[model samples]
Target: MTEHTDDTDDTIEGHERELSAVREEHDDADDDVSLSLPGLSVDRRDFMKAGAAVGAATASAGCLDALSGGGSADQETASGGAKNHKVAPGELDDYYAFLSGGHSGEIRVMGVPSMRELLRIPVFTPEPASGYGYDDRTSEMLEEEGGGYSWGDTHHPRVSQTDNDYDGRWAFVNDKANGRMARIDLEYFETDAIVDIPNQQGTHGACCLLPDTKYVFGVGEFRVPMQNDGRDLDDPEAYTSTIAAINPETMNVEWEVEVDGNMDNGDGGKDGRWFFTTGYNSEHATTESGMTKADRDWVKAFDVPAIEAAVENGDYEEINGVPVVDGTRESSLNQSDRPIVRYVPTPKSPHGVSVTPDGDYAIASGKLDPTCTVIDVEKLAEADDPADAIVGRPRVGMGPLHTAYDGRGHAYTTLFIDSQVAKWDIEAAVEAEAGSEDPIVEKIDVHYNPGHLIASESYTADPEGDYLISLNKLSKDRFLNVGPLKPENDQLIYIGDDEEGMQLVKDKPSYAEPHDASIVSADKIEPADVYDPSDYDAEFVAEGDESIERIDDSTVHVKTYVKRNEYAFPEIRVQEGDEVRITASNVEETSDITHGMAIPEYDVDLALAPQDTREVTFTADEPGVYWVYCSYFCSALHLEMRSRLIVEPSE
Candidate 1:
């Protein structure tokens, strides 16, 4: 274990505080003889440690042992024991799940079966602990491109595809608050680039990739300027449901199209010779003037014909997904040249949209309605009358938010108001004649308001996973009272070949409020575990990294490396009014080896993974001494990785 220089008083003080906190927690747990709760994963100090990842980082993608909370038993009731998902510490997880840390503007990485939180990937917001917003390079990404604004609300995370399966190449997430789309390279699991959806103010249902990985789409959440500035925000009819296609290779704007009226959030799209995404008022709502409850209720009964007609007659001109117009509203919406997107309206304030495995049906769920609206894609494509394209709106439960398909035989829809999961046979219900058993098969109750339930491999071409994680919004009485704002509980459930029911297995406490997640089998990913200087890419990225340097009298470029048992950096000395830029890279050569740097009294915390680089620029306005230390725990001597920053008084 090594540090930048001799330890200072600030360094010692911070180290003592962290050690004391850890010891107090362990000591308190030791006093409690029994650690049991109603349907919670048993607490294990060993599993909670950060080192549990060092050994299991190379494990395969299919272990059936129960871990964390709950018992692993093949039970048949609500209170039955969990199925076989238990595993030892440092054991490889069968899958890797990436969950959006709602308002925190980051994504949490967890392993399936064990339900261990392995990593937190910063996305739209400034994560000081990970040096995300502090790193000079990434700090720019957090802010609005044309403005000084930073911080964003990230909602959905969708992994890229190869052959319709998770290719472990890219993961796309949406910034609902910023209307920005980000691409995370799976090789390093770091956000490489982010492209703003031009002409839109906010984004919701975005980053849905096509089957062949040719193009990914970003749909605007709100009806804003839509490239036409100064549009009256009060007029909902003036707003448009705008969407754009981005070439995956370049991650640049290819072409975009729009239709009139508020379409809300979209879905992970499916294209069978053509692209499709059903609409919903999913937070990224309309700008209708003083939209009354009555107006919303009236809008709930949407007319699919108007939507279909608008899309069909959109007068689109661009071909092969190319950009061919000025970055203006009229130029973008020439009406003579726009891609048409068919709309099929349904009851129930729709929130999410999904397509079945066979690409036969597109399902949209209304959060306030008691049923979900289904649109048959194949039928719509071949229909002589596009106005009559809605397949059915099967009554399920109140407030259906999102749906996950099990490529095998069923679809699971999360009912928010009722806190239940409604299961139905997709093909059976889509093709079943009325009065037939009604494909509405069963219902399972979860702990609290469940926002999203991801079936193993749900978003893929085939669902090969046996676990289902229900991301609940409210913890309620599920776990011990932490505070007024309880942690989000992501409960793990077994959704195997059992024709009976899915059983609750574990309760994993989550950070912030998680929105949506992406999980693929571990075998599907092959990220290099070592830090290769050649792998680093971003603006101002240095080929060979080193510790502290004085680029100029008033400017400093400090580079550091984070490795197990050590964070190497040189002493930092600056005068008041000096602009300090720190470029920190984690050059560890092992999988899951990550480090973070945090400077006291400054909002500079960043996560550095093997070969990943981030830079932070800050002006030393205050004259004082500050301590720099690693925020993420990576090794037994992680505490030893510390440095001192001395800001001398200006003359």
Candidate 2:
């Protein structure tokens, strides 16, 4: 009984073997056993052995013994309860989370803490529910470049910022399926502009410049020919990608800087000086097998000021009516020229690159390796070699994809293969020895594989460490079995204090897939409850403008007004082949009162809030009386509100 052996291994592989033994001892034990840890509920031995074995085993033997006994929390479930973070009925949420609908082609506004979906703003797609693409005003915006796109794959949603903090005036999102970007006005909660990016394909990463949001930058994820005029189809070496800078005010492409490799994700500096994006395919691989051959990829950094200055000095070439600058390593290193782009080498196939809240360090996640590479941005600009800028390579876990901040010197990174979130200390990681486990504080298992995670205001200068959302890709048995397809699970975790750990408070089911989201405080955004006709074009009328004008022999412009239970123009007469343009204005000044206009046989629908005006244009080809009714429930007499459009036969 007194046999003592000091054979316990301190190395990672040694601890890994010890962890295997612990796992075998608990083979037949209940895996759902609650632990004394703040939010852990799995079997004590299994929890330490499975997702976070190596990091846990690095601790002293005495600490491991205490963890196995299950220390203190008397009453809690495996997924953590929501008693403390519950949002009562009729209560307002503390923050607003703008989520990008991956393939849904829209932006979903959700209330934080409550996980309630507030609105779905259609950006690059047509929505029959809100008449987004059906209305003439939005139709013009969609057909601006003459592309009839019905769907889009939105990736990232970035809010406009001032002084490195959210200003809440506009939100920018990218369409991965189509090379385009959209701007959503926060006040009206509507999309105002959509721009097709020139000379860039597969536009993936999008972010507004910090400190003032001077420009919105988007990076192309797929490499293609610079001319793209049916040339260099088989030459992988000739293909390259470019990062374009868009003028936020005009929503136009200002200039583009060509770079090496294919970019994936990006983040901007707090001072609006640098923009960095991850390159997952640095090998310039045409096939999937060739992509993983390289031991290291890169995070390409773009000098924004230098690019802008080059454009002003006309030190660039022209392609498709846009200025293009050569920023490749070969051209940048020639004769010691001022480089506009620098490629900082990182571990294999990096996925997401995010800057720290303080804007000091750029953390790039290693997708193929079990670590994250942290680079010093200031040093990166002047480094003679790309590898010299790297400060630390913290061993987090398997398949680290993205990182979020707590503003308390901590970083929470999502491990895709491990299906867990690893919380690490930033300063400790940079100062500790390589491969040391001191940086990793704790890790908790999510429901399934999570691709992206976001904390409250994590990307800004002042990150509030209150909550985090895990955008998991699978929800196997979390809810009732619903046919073959299931909704994605978005787990909400309370990440308030250092000692609280990550408590899984709720499991919110999101439709299809949601890639990324930006969380901001509620006080920063002030949405308008109603619209003002005075702030719109003169063609919109709130009073005394209900008349029909014959624009030409076959075109008519019908100006109509609406209120409670009535339409100003009860009947409109037009010829069979006449082109009809109808503008419906709601004159009600109440906060919640809204009106809808719909024509039965025609694909026409419009939603008008109080004091709002919208237009619909269509050809009256069918010679019949179409009943127009209110599609939205506004009042008790909603059923009685109707109008008739009589299309007479041609003489």
Top candidate on TM-score is 2
lDDT of 2 by residue, 1-651 (tens): 111212211222343344334323433433221110011112223333442333222211111112124332223532344346767899999999999998989999999989999999999988877788888878888887515677788989999998888999999999888888899999988888898888888899888888788988888888998889999998988888888888889999999988888889999988888999999777788886677666557888888888888789887889999999888777743225557787787765789999999999999987765678888888877787767777777778766899999999999998765667888999898886555557888776665568999999999999998899989876554556586777888978777756656666677888887899999999999999888677677366656878988899899999999998999888999999999999888889898887889995988888888888888889999998999999889999999999999999997
Which pairs, if any, clash in model 2?
Answer: none
Residue 355's lDDT in candidate 1: 67
TM-score of 2: 0.89
Which residues of candidate 2, in runs, are more than 4 Å off?
Answer: 1-83, 332-337
User: Residue 372 of model 1: what lDDT?
Assistant: 64
Candidate 2, poorest ten consecutive residues by summed lDDT: 32-41
Candidate 1 lDDT by residue in tens digits, 1-651: 111122222332343344234223322222111111011111222211332232112111011122212222233333233455776876799999988877776778899878888877877766555566566666665564412446666777888887677888888887777777788878776776777767666677654555666666676656654336565666554556566666777778766666544445554434524454544443334432233122121111112223334436553444334332222224333222222333344442456777676666767775644556667666665554443556565656555788887676788888665555777777676575422336766665554568887887887778875888888775544456687777777877776755535666677777677788877899998877755666546432333556566777888767666567655654677888888887766766576777877885877777777667677788888888898888888888878878778899988
Per-residue lDDT, model 1, residue 627, is 84
**Per-prediction count of colliding residue pairs?**
36, 0
